[model samples]
Structures are given as C-alpha cells and as structure tokens.
Target: MVRHWWLILIACWSFSLSADEVTDLYESRIEVATQSRDDRQDALREAFSSVLIKVSGQRDVLERPEVSRQLSQATNYLVQYSYVTERQQLYLRAQFDEQRIEELLRRANASYWSARRPNIIFWIAQETQRGARLIGRDADSEIVPAMRRQAHQRGLPISFPLLDLTDLSNLSASDVWGRFERPVQEASRRYPSDGLVMVRVQEGDNGQGYLAQWTLIVGNTRRSGQVDTEDLNGIGMAVVDSVTDRVAAEYAVSYSETEASEFTIRIINLQDLESVLLVESLLRRLASVEQATLARYHQGTAEFRLQLIGDMRRALQALELDNRMQRVEDPWSVTASPVLEYRWLR
Candidate 1:
C-alpha cells in the first residue's frame, strides 16, 4: 500500500503539482477489493461520500439528514466511473456532478469550499532507530508517501521543502523539531504558499507506537495538534485531517440564503488591464457570489458590484480566503457604509 502511494507521489512531482489552485474537486478514487458488480456498487457509494467530504471540506457531511438521504442513492450523483488498476490493486475512479453536489450542500445547509484552496508547505522531522532526519521533496521515505496520500484524500494541497543547499543553510532538523514558527515561516518564503505546517514524529513510549506533533500557521492565526497511533499511516492521516478541519472552517462558505443580495467593493492598486481582469474573475468565481460586474474604474482603482448568495459578512470572509487581495482599513469611509475596501496584491 505504501509503495503504491510513493509511486503516485513521484508522478505528481513530475507534473509540478501546485496545491494552491486545485482542480477536479468533484472526483475521487476508492480502492476496491474486487471488480464484481456488488463491489463496484459499494465502491461507488464510498467514492460519492469521499467526494462530498472533499468538496465540502468536512469529513462529517454524510451525517446530515439531507446528505445521508442523497448518499443512499449515490449513483444518481455519479457522472462517470471506471475501474483502474495500480500496483495490482483494483480501484474505482468516480466523478460526480458539481452542480448537483452544490445543490445538495445547500439543501443540507452545509459549507461548500471552492476549488481555490490554500497551499500548505510542510517541514517534518522524524526520530527513528537510526537518528533524526528531515523529510524533503526528494526524500525516499515512507512518511512522505503516507502524508501525500492523506492530503490527496482530504483534497488538501501540501508541499514539502526541497531541502537543497539553500534550505539546509537556513533551517535545520532541530529547528523543525522545536516547532519554531519564525524560522520556519521565514525559510518558507521562497515557496509561494498560504499556510505553513511543522511536524515532529517519533516512537511512542516503550517504542510501542508512533506519535506526531504538528503546528499549522496561516497568517496571524496558528493551530496545533498531536496524534498517536500504532502505525505511521494513521499518524499521517490524523495530522492532515486536523489541519484540514481548521483550514476549512476558516474558508468554507455555509449556504443559508434563498436569494442573492447585492454588494459592492472597491479594489485599489490595479496595475494594468490584466490585473483588472484577474480581480473580476476571482470575484465571479467565489462560491458565495452569484455574479460580479465592474461598476466603475477610476485612477487605477476598480469597484465591483457583486450579487452574493450570502450576507456581506460571509462574502467578505470568502474574499479573505483568496490571497490576491488584502483588506484595507480605510479611515475616510463611514463606519456604516456597505461598500468594502481592499487592495489588490497582484
């Protein structure tokens, strides 16, 4: 099983995977024991559940009454599926209908996380019988493959450091083992990522199991978790799940509105036509927004009026998740004004 994941990781690296911009959010692959009709049906249901969890960024989404009813008929939501073989293991790769999935989330009043997700860079140090070593992009270790498998399962984008001469010169195994946020964040600047994760794993008491300590840093907010399991794969899965919960809570949009509301925002620091187009595209692509139109452009600043599915607050929260813009606290604007202010970052 671990070897299968290692091969997948190598293939992903060859494609120069970027975690920030995620595609195929509505697809999932589940390992099946056999290719029989009964097994195929069961795998399809599990794959549908995985898609729901991945799309909503919530592992417990299947527990909702509406979602559970839909899951009972998971085949209705599946767009296509085919059997795939890897490492002599049979699997089902399934694609679900995106629009239907979004409607199901709205019916359940659950949060929908768009494909635009944060890219988290990880620095991991481990202690084993041999000694301490850091896992890097080029590491041929079991831990890296396990972590990558978990990240893909959760629909989270994660990157490991190159650990080349430059990285080693700036960071050490002890620095990550200590969970130092400053040095880790400083060294991670070379990689364009939205979050920083530092982890340390070692043998548990009496060498009976594995224990992992992880810290997640996104901007000013920070979170940490500890996991202990009898095997390395369990530790990796738990650590990734813990971080995904935090990130999803911060970014996912909870659907509660029956109709769209009009909202306006002003974005400054636009450099050219390309910047303006990118800003409009981002606004229109937000899960909370129904439509976006440029209302005004003056003095290199642009104002967009958006038809949002949620309230202004929720829309603003969604905007904060994208790194292309930064909220600006304009002192001249009235406190009760409905229009928000931001500065384009690119």
Candidate 2:
C-alpha cells in the first residue's frame, strides 16, 4: 500500500512539469510574432485590397482562411517575425510599401528599352568614275570605325565584321551583285548585319556644301528609311545615332560610351632584333594605350631605345610609378646597359 502511494505521487509530479513546459513554449511564440498597432493597420489595408501574404514553410499553423485573413490584415501593424532554422534566430521587420514597389517596376520596364543593340551598317559616297575614290578612302571611313565608336560609347558588343563599301567600288553593277551573292549563297549565310545604310553626297541646293541623303535597307526583305541634311558632319553623326537608336530598340540592349584618354611612353633600350617582339608584347598588354611601337634604337658603346604610346595616366596608376625605370640623359651611359624612355604617342 505504501509503494502504490509513492508511484501515484511521482506520476503527478511528471504531469505538472510537462504542462509548465508547454505553456512556456506558447508564451514565447506569441511574444516573438506579435506586431505594433500601426503596422497591423497597414497590413490590414493591404490584405483587404486583394494582396495575400505567401508563406511557404510551416504554413499548416495558419491553415484556416479566417486566420490567414486576420494575419494579412494585421501584418503591417503586427511585427513580422521569421525564424531561420540555420541561423537559429528570429527577424522582425516591416512590410514593403506598395507605392515604392510600383515605382521600381516602372523603372525596370524603362531600362529594357535603353538596353538594346543596333543592327545597321553605314557607308559614305564620293564622286569617282569607277568609284575608285571610294576605294582610296581609308578603312576608318567604313561603317566599322563609326559603328565601333558608337558601339563603344553605347557599351555594345561588336558581334561581327563591319563591311566596307569601298571594296565594291571597283566592281561593275553585275560584279557587285555577284560579289554580294556568291558568298551570301555559298554557305547559306545570314548577314549578321540587320540592315545596310547608304549615304550619298551630291551638290547641295546652295551649292556651297554637299547634300547628304541617308538610306537604310533592312536585309533582302528591304524595309527602307531615309533622312537628308546639308551639313555633312551633322548629317553623318545624326544618321548614325538615329540608326543606332532604332536598331538598339529592336535588339533590346542599352547603349552608352566611355571616353578613353590617350597615354604616351618612350622606350630608350630596344635593339633592332628585340624591337619587334618587345613592342608587340607591350602593345598587346597595354590595350588602353592607343599605340605603342619602337620608334628608334641607336647602337654605340651603350644602346638607346625609344617607344611612343598612349594612355600614360592609366599606365602610371597601374604600375604605381615607383617600379618603372628612369629616363637616360647621357648618351654614353646608354651604351653600357641600353636605356629605355617612355613618351606619349600623339
């Protein structure tokens, strides 16, 4: 009879301890999840207007529709608390403002329009019997240089070669047709270019300057547009900009230009044998420097070398100035170990 009484007392003590632990857990949960009055009111407004809080994990705790509605309504006023299992911590935060979020979405849409690539090629026309004058013009006159410059400014990639119309100047109309056709047909080639721009310069209405007409042809399907101007520089720049904007819009890429300043360096220790290789290596590494080459290497008791390049400012910044060797004044000291001097390439 005494043993039975002892067993009953032990069981009652165990029950009381378990009940206390459960109550403590419930109180802690309530304390962590409760929110402020203002936050709850804001959350309620959002909840009433068709917005819903999406909680993925542990959603069974608030499964009832009424519970969810109440939670959403009080979310703004109620402190939002999240328990991160990995971190083992609770985060209390406020809800996002709908007005601010809507503005962000609108700006994102605008960015889509600005981030487009252009797909047009441009050419310039000059008077010539067989169009030899066109061929005589430099490669820089072709769409490649102007387009590359524009693309660089707009922060676009050069996806393909910029073809020059000068190459077609020597050909007859039939030759021109065949030249364009053979390569185009041989491999079933798709002209990586989206459109071709032809700029024709003729005597102006005033006869003082040239009258420029810009024509754009969109592939073989042939959708064309034209613009005319009296100032060649203005017309050229305007046509390129307009065509770039249109093509960029079509391709969906943003355009912007970064202007790179020129830097010059002179090397005073290059021999004829080492000149080519050394200059080539230097040029390859210093891409930001517009041009770099061995200008002259004189041999006596000591050797003297000269190198001219662009972008000295960046070079100094990159090299930290302290490590690079110094310039030589005495021609005699040059003969002993070969002196190198750096100068800006004009």
Candidate 3:
C-alpha cells in the first residue's frame, strides 16, 4: 500500500457514523473451515491478523517485530472459540482479548485508528461492454459486492451515492470519470461524510485484466492510485488497501494519550444519571484521562475535572472513535471563552 503519513490535528465538524454502531469493531470473528486441524490454526491466525490491521490502522502491523512474534501463539489470545455446523460444513467462531490487543499496540506505539472511523462516500464509474456507467446506492454491479467484501475484511466503512434525482443532477459518471473536483465534492457534501472517494474502472486490453483508478479527498488533502487486476474482485481488494492505508495514515495517529494536565470539561445533552455515568465511565477509561471526577450536573449539562496524561487531541481521537461523545462544533455561549464541551452522541 502506498502511504504519506499526515497526522490529523482536527476532528471533523460533524460525523454521520455513531459510536454505538462501531462498538463491536474490536471483536474479530471469522468463519473457519473444519476440513483439517491445520485449517483451525490458520483460521486463528487470520482472525488475529484482521484484528491487528483494524486495531492498528496499519496493514502490515501484524508483520511488526513484536506483533509477528506473537502469531505463533495466536490462539493464546483467543478468549473463546466454538464450532457450529451449517449446510454440511462446520464453522469456527473465535473471540480474542480486546484489552490485550490494545496493550500490545500502546506498547508498540502503533497508530491506533479508532473504530470511530471517517465516513467515506464512494463515487465509482465502471465501464461495461455497452458503456461506462456510475454505480449508485441501488446498484447490483459487480464492483459493489466486491468492494463490500474487501471493506468488511478491512473493517472499513464505505457508502455509495444515491444516484437519485439530486445526485444525478449534481454529478454524473463523466464527472467522476473525469475527476471533476468541485462537482464531485459538492455532490458528496449531501452525505454526513468527512471525505470523498472517486473510483473509475475500465476494461483493460482484452484477456489481460481490468484497471481501477481511484482518488480520495479529505479536506485539503487528496491522494490517488490505480490497480490492474484480472478481475473486479482483485481490483476491489486493492482499492480497500489503498484507501485504508491513506486514511489510516492520516487518522490512525501513533501518539498515545498521557496524563499530565488537568482541565474542567462541560458536557451537554445528558438527560439523566445514566448518561452522566456513561460519559464519566467513557472518560475514565481513556489512557489519557488519569482521573475524571464529576464536578456537578445542572439542567441537563454536566461538568467534570479531568487529569490527562496527554493533550485533548489524542484523547478526543480515542473518544470519537468510540462515537459516544464528540466535540461540540459551535458552543453557543455569552462569554468570549467557553469551557471545553462535548455533545453526547447516544
């Protein structure tokens, strides 16, 4: 995968994908064939490998010296495993220790891409025997399923344009194929997304393979790449690798939270004691927050004193990844300086 490390310094103003939707990301479970004992071992390694990639936002993280040394003991991390028979085949489902994985990453200083990832809207153009067409939200095209499978493997979340009246009116297949920035970016603004990805696919020389070209846009930063494969499936996998590598590089920050400073934080939208306690638990769990003590709660707003190991940036990244709470975009206050505030996303 091609990469250009760009440490993200700011959070998106708005996020479409919520925290509850991503809570299950740490649990890696894959179906394993029961054909042989070796298959079980291989499956365990594969599942752990997936966990490593998703957790670290580094495709080659499993190959890291410390991480690679543990693969032989892949099953050692497996918290539980089970066998289920379905349609003449037995499937093995495995669960690994989430805390152990996080501890390993922190020790390695790996770029931990929180499960609360950016929402990417894909505008893919495909060339067929008859013509070039845009893949839409309702598309049953080959690239859609292939991309979905690859995305699932990478634990990357992606969405397609609706191609409805609005999308078609604002942008077209030619716009994406031609890489028209203003129109494509404008079209993507309709979604609750942080970035825009455009993909163009065409048939290569007969019997050779297919060619897939792609570009990703996150604010002012943009990156593009291409892949040549025998079929669309291979191309889709390549697309996932390319996109995740770039996104991970930008957002999968390597800096771990540290405890050094203390600050008072204000939270809004806490409806009850449950919400207050939930936010408190979330804050205290972060490695950055050395201590989080509730200050007070009045009129649906809550306050806390946080002793942080690091700055708010890393802590925000981790908390945002969980999707339970997010920084307030615009805090309406009468004073010139307002307290640091986050909105509950639940």
- What TM-score would each prediction reach against the true structure? 0.84, 0.30, 0.76
lDDT of 3 by residue, 1-346 (tens): 1111111211112224452234555556567656478988987888788878877877878767788888778887888877777787777667788878877887766656656577777899898767678998779877788877777667777888889999889977889998888999999888877788899998888658999889999645699999888988888788888998887776665645433677888899999766776677666656456678777788889988887655666566556655457777655665754468888877
Model with the higher lDDT, candidate 1 or 2: 1
Q: TM-score ranking from best to worst?
A: 1, 3, 2
Steric clashes per prediction: 0, 47, 7
Model 1, poorest ten-residue lDDT window?
A: 9-18
- Alpha-carbon local distance difference test for all models: 0.83, 0.35, 0.75
Superposition TM-score, candidate 2 onto the true structure: 0.30
Off by over 4 Å in 1: 1-19, 129-131, 256-263, 269-275, 307-339, 343-346
Index of the highest-TM-score prediction: 1
Off by over 4 Å in 3: 1-20, 29-35, 85-90, 128-131, 189-192, 204-207, 219-221, 253-264, 269-275, 281-301, 305-311, 314-339, 342-346
Cα deviation at 139, candidate 3, in Å, is 2.6
Pairs that collide in candidate 1 are none
